[model samples]
Target chain A: MKKLMNVPNDVVDEMIEGYAAAYPQYVRICAENKRSVVSSKPVRPGKVGIVIGGGSGHEPAFMGLIGPGFADGAPVGNVFASPPPDPVLQVTKAVNGGAGVLYMYGNYAGDCMNFDMAAELAGMEGIRVETVLVTDDVASASKEEAHRRRGIAGGFLVFKAAGAAADKGYALDDVVRVAQKANASIRTMGVALSPCYVPQTGKPSFMLGDDEMEIGLGIHGEPGVKRGKLGTADEVADSLLSTITADMPLAAGDRVAVIVNGLGSTSQMELFIVFRRVARLLADLGVEIHRSFVGEFVTSLEMGGCSVSVMKLDDELAEMVDHPADTPLYVQK
Target chain B: MKKLMNVPNDVVDEMIEGYAAAYPQYVRICAENKRSVVSSKPVRPGKVGIVIGGGSGHEPAFMGLIGPGFADGAPVGNVFASPPPDPVLQVTKAVNGGAGVLYMYGNYAGDCMNFDMAAELAGMEGIRVETVLVTDDVASASKEEAHRRRGIAGGFLVFKAAGAAADKGYALDDVVRVAQKANASIRTMGVALSPCYVPQTGKPSFMLGDDEMEIGLGIHGEPGVKRGKLGTADEVADSLLSTITADMPLAAGDRVAVIVNGLGSTSQMELFIVFRRVARLLADLGVEIHRSFVGEFVTSLEMGGCSVSVMKLDDELAEMVDHPADTPLYVQK
Candidate 1:
């Protein structure tokens, strides 16, 4: 229970309060639905409203991405649990600007169930809500089962492209097409050297021996494909990237955007070390890099590891990916 | 030591290579000095050049801040060790821009000696250089000896003010004055519940019993003023904010910018919990918050703790603080 929190049950409430207070210009807690965070910027009419949500603990993921050029709203949930249909429906309705609403999030069972229910509810009200599930964690499944792969850091690329598309006044179907393409083109894989604690349990969700690492752990401490002694940053990067590129069969002439994400406890210095290897390996393969991002975009609360995500880009995807975005946690100009 | 690095001795070099590769648009390693990181943007003549540096563990601090609206260059060092004079002198010479350069860093003995020597060397070459040491950690010393206090997250404010001032084309002396004023107005304090391992040492730097926390700990695991059972986020925020306000004697109606900085391992959710209390406490005290930043701005490598910094603001300082600055880690527009 070494976490700096109040009563374990109150962590989400207190965190939501703090988040709204800290970034008043960018977001505000939804008055109609306490669990939803809404962007402060006015929604433009006839623009596809972008809504993203998932479990808590992965700060700056679903909530921090809410702004003018990003998600219009995010329904926050309890730690490692999906937001219920009530809040999801509330947020979808609140952000609906007559063009329709798009619900985007990681591909998880609970999230899939809840968001589906929300979409049905919105349909009853004639809101025309669409959904895109991100499945980019290459290590989560075999190539034949790519649709079953879990989403990780690669969700960031999906959000960026979809948000940019919606901001461009694209129709709901067009925005959904862009989001699905972004999700399909991205791949991510991660390694874990340490476990994260759950406040409710007051203990680590999993365990690893000293000097050991897991090759492909999930954000919620789900079992990975392998566990062994920790290797150097270069070795770890090679293993993850090889798993990813093999799954996608990326070509030498492909241009990609790269992201080296820290899973909470990993230092940015270590991420850069990993990124160095990623860049060199891609260069060796003749895969050109269009842009690169390195920092804590997706995280497993205090879990020690890093994830690398690569998104193959075409001209349309490249333009949307490079579009300017300004949010509390991310900014591009 | 669960760190992702190759041969601990080569960590710094690898990190530098990776950083340059990851952020080619923002920075590049100095050709003449391998340890220096220079901004990719061209320096405008007659503007005071800003050079910031320190140890290597605090990622996105010294290096991430090098860009058009921030530092011009940063001399890299080994983990938890001050950089030598060679890289400092080289960076100073390279970013001179025919005007002058301002050297700013935390108030530390090794840094003091090294930067002083660099200034002397630059002086001999007719490259005018001034130094401003940030002393904002209120718990490091008594108010009577405030100048002897250590710098922590508050140093970010000093860098922001100085960078904005220099970007405004202020003379070297004027930029120095603005930096000194910012240093004087800011205060910071932190608490640590776990220790960080140094890659070179292959073990933790310090130890804390389970369920215990040390208040006012230094960035390098230095001893704090008190040790006790870990408390709630609200209680911890109260303890830290009370100490900071008392030392500065901040009065009602005072406006300030607040930063709830994660040392390294603390989750952003916990940071928001602490910040919720910070905003509530300040409101209760009748103090107005102009802007707030909550994240890992400055960090100890994987240390589980957080620091709070407050900068009392006047009109000039407020405007400069809000001025747009674009860097790899920070951007305002």
Candidate 2:
């Protein structure tokens, strides 16, 4: 209830308005669909349009990534809630060039249903649209049930690959192929030390004992694999990496991109500490880190935790990962 | 305290080790000075070197800014503590090209004393060193005693201007002048809703009632001017902007760069809400926003609060702000 909001009910609208005002050069709210945020820079005609969407609490994730060499548009939703089909369709229509549009988002039931409906609506208008569900959270499912895993920070890598491939003028189908491939290669797991509050409800999405931590919690406070006493950064990193690598099985010579992402309230200082342990563990396992990112990328609302994600990279994915991107929240060159 | 640290006493060293590991591409620990982090990329000959240092908790500040077109070296200290003179001297020696070196840090007593000592030591070794203390926290002192005000997030602007000026091969005196000018043109203020715990202390820096907020709180949990019931984001933004503009009045034709920085725990969604109001207030006053930065730049561990910084821009400062620079945390082109 200590959030800096105007009214609990208006959090999403005010946030979107503020975001548009702050980054006028990078994005603008769609005139026809107030919930849709589209890049100010028009999408090139031949490039595949990348449309990303999800709930609104996770800043710079779905919307902040809309810019050149990134998502073409994002249909923002209420906090921890899915966007309606209207905004998704509108965003697709706004960003659809000569090529088709791709819908990428986390694997959530509400999100999947809404986006699917939007895709159907887009298809009725003769626009080609594809959907790629990110399911990289290793702790959410066993290897044989990978499709059941929920997406988390690893979606960033998938977005990067998809956006880069689209920027390279890949066909819509090829972009989807690369995105699916990137999705398959990435794995993520998180440890939650505290819970996050939802503005509308004025309550934490979940609760945890002060001395306990939950391993593999979802972005929206979904149940993780286990709850145990809080451990040191090194111990937590080991648990996350063990869970992730067990599912993905990284080899000594394999190259990968790593993300030590804060769940929300965790400090960058702590993330780096976790990253230190993760880097050493990976080195011992013979996995070469092609690039490393440590920060708050995807987050719950003021949750205290961190997640580790690894994207096993091939030459194509490596090139895509290195592709230049400029967005409000993240930038690379 | 529920912190992700191995040992409270080892937090500083572990944080430094993790930072070095995560960003080996940009920096490395100075062999002789374990406390100093010097850029892996050497300073160009005859360029005025920029050396920034402070406590270790503010990740991506003193150290993350060390790279091409930014700080050449950063001597890190323990949590919320100023670094010793030896490491500062070592960093100065390591990055001191033929020209000279600039020592930039917050206007704090311990830092000022230690850096002054470092400059004297560097002088003994025949290295030229100049200092610019950032004093931009309008809430910390009256306008008549602005020089006594504590430095805060506005220091980022001063650093960026100084680094850009030096990178452009400005003479030492010119670089110092520009840095001072940048510092003079910037002002900042913050509000804290909750306290951040120091790892070693295992207690919150300060205390607050559940529904209360402290306006103009310092980054290290220093007391602020007022404590009142938490208000809407717009109301908070109005109070912060009014205080800042009163000290450093802006004209209708003025242009400025604005940063709505989260102290640590504020969600990006809430930050945008604050920024929305900030933009409207500035626009109503006829001040043009040259650029907007909305994220955590300088932070206070996991403090729950935010600071707003405004740098009034003249043509020279505007150009310097627009200059291309890339660091781990910030990149502009």
Candidate 3:
């Protein structure tokens, strides 16, 4: 649970200041609200603005995803906590253009309520704002309760698609449509080998035995399928993907984008090993991996674990997924 | 000390397989030797080939640094252990286009000896090869013994400059010169908060108290400056930068590129907090930060800490640093 920080109270503020300074070419802090981080690149006058945000522990999610072809603005929260409505409103206003704006975030209760409130405020300002709740973590609920599932690393793809739509000058409604469609087709499941610490707190947020691991754990160390004896990379991949494929039902000839995302403390070495198993399993099922992303896209402090997210791709989704993105942490051409 | 892998002995082999599978568009294992990972993008005829490599465990260093506009090939070794001369020879043969090949790696004793042998073999085969040994880790030795200093994350910049030179059609000697200049201008220092366990050993590589940290730690568990009570991020960054600036003697009106590198388990949040202090310190000295890179550029398994690297930039080095590179773990335009 050790951390390298100054005063715990100053963690978020100082971190954001450092982030903006480190990535001056890509991001800037909002003048109205210090917590709101926006792309330095301006959005066109009539283009729909894409705004994505969530808790602060997920570094690249809310912050790293803001750039030329991704989310236009991001309102960062305290670690594992949702941002207040004011920052969200600030981000919405900053990124808003003549075509209105779209708000995308994980399907957490605090986030939904705060974002809805911000949307209402934006509406009063004559800006048409829409919301796309990313409910892509299949492990959070049964398939029958898919709408209730929480979002995890799979939201990376969901936001990527919406970002591409906004960058392509899609209308607000179209951007929301693409985000929702991407969310519906994506599923993620994660395993936690250890717990993480919140900066303000000096203790672990949760607990796990030395020889135990939680399959399908939430990003913030929420209960998973079950905490059991630790398994090998292959076994963990099989468990997570089996549940995901069962829920999404990928058949032969289906093309998909695979993300073997490290939660926090896990290394790329281990993530790629898990990805190797994921590739073999999918090939056995005769599914084609159109694209593969293996690294820490979304994280939870320094938690030790990883997640596997698969987004079933079609013509439109594939094109959006292939769109260019130039962000602080992620760049593609 | 828990890990996600099938077998201890198979860690390196399987990890390489996973890396090649995850980035099939960018890399492939050489047919002659599975340890040799070469770029999928073919090097043009008469272009000086960039062959970079070292031990495994540092996932993104050798492996991730191979792609378009980067290293043409990388011969991966077992965890924290150097590769034999054979794989290096295979990599030389695979990347040798017509102008010959350039070997770039850290200045470890094993790497120097092994790569030297490979260069001798390539010369016997009539392929002229030159080398640039990276010795940028200022913590390893004093300025008087700078040539004996080990390379750390600063090797990332050295290799990057050389890669751009090769991609820009620099001759073997020219690429070697660029890499050498980049190495001479760069300096790096690191701190370790805890120990990491190798897959095969299943034991901590070194030891540290719960409230202790080792300043000036190397990539492996090599001896560092000292072990003492852990300090705040600001204090640590100050200490590291003080030593580095004292060694390099940067003055006003100087421009430099900085890298705040996470060893392994350290999160980006902490790294940026560290980078924020680094920015402030450099600003106090009236130094211009040409660019800043804050993330896991190089690592040591799941070690918990970070390193700070700064490279003095002239127009030539700046262009080489800013050149486009497409790699699995890193990308830029």
Docking category of candidate 2: high
TM per prediction: 0.99, 0.99, 0.99
Off by over 4 Å in 1: none
Off by over 4 Å in 2: none
Output the worst ten-in-a-row residue range by lDDT, candidate 3 chain A: A219-228
Please provide the root mean square deviation of candidate 3 (C-alpha atoms, Å): 0.9
Clashing pairs in 3: none
Q: Encode model 1's per-residue lDDT on B1-333: one tens digit a residue.
A: 788888889888988898888778888888888998888777778879999989988877888888766799999888978999999999998789988999999999999999999999999999999999999999989999999998888998899999999998989989999999999999999999888888888888678898899999888766578888899899999999999989987789999999999988999999999999999999999999999989988888888889899999999889878978888888877
Candidate 2's DockQ: 0.80
TM-score of chain B of each: 0.98, 0.98, 0.98
Lowest-lDDT window of 10 residues in candidate 3 chain B?
B220-229
- Give the residue spans of candidate 3 off by over 4 A: none
Comparing 1 and 2 by DockQ, which wins?
1
